[model samples]
Target: MTDPTQDFRRHLGQHEYELLEDDWLALLEADVSPALLFETAELAARYAPGEIPKTLLRVLADWLGEKGAHRWRLEALRRLLALGEDGPDLPAR
Candidate 1:
């Protein structure tokens, strides 16, 4: 099977990637929908402009919330990303 993380992994080097590995694996194992993964990828890209900000990554994780509820997670990411595009940077603290 294809590695689901491959898409987002390109944006993160080893050390940074390790921080999110567990959560990514959990989401994968739970069989989150493709749409959710897509939103996650967008969030990953948005979270990291050039250097991956660990703080923003943590925020991304927070936006994603827990597993099991893919729809809302996807929706949350979409709205967040949209707001990010239209307004200021993501919520930092």
Candidate 2:
């Protein structure tokens, strides 16, 4: 049997793996913190870039509203907007 967690870790970049592990552990242990989620999302945006899908964006939008971090929400929104524009900085893989 494959180890899903390990596989996930392998596909993720170092920073992405760290942030994702922290977030997953928090969720699994029911000890989630706003800061942790925020940091995870920020790191995802930075390291993974366009790796976040639209469905996840909707979820993040809701979470951002609930967490009262409109700035982060706006940043995510801007990324979505920029994705529709012509750009070479986007991740191509």
Query: Which candidate number has the best TM-score?
Result: 2
Per-prediction count of colliding residue pairs? 0, 0
- Residue 60, candidate 2: Cα error in Å is 0.9
The candidate that wins on lDDT is 1
Single out the weakest 10-residue window by summed lDDT for candidate 1: 50-59
Residue-wise lDDT of candidate 1 within 1-93, one digit each (tens)? 545565346435443554554546555676766566556655665554543333333344454566545455545445555444333544432
- In order of appearance, the predictions have TM-scores of 0.34, 0.39
- Candidate 1: which stretches are off by over 4 Å? 1-18, 49-93
Global lDDT scores for all candidate models? 0.51, 0.49
Residue pairs clashing in model 1 are none
> Which tens-of-lDDT digit does each residue in 1-93 have in candidate 2?
444344334445654543554444433245345455444545455555454533344455556666687776665555555545333433332
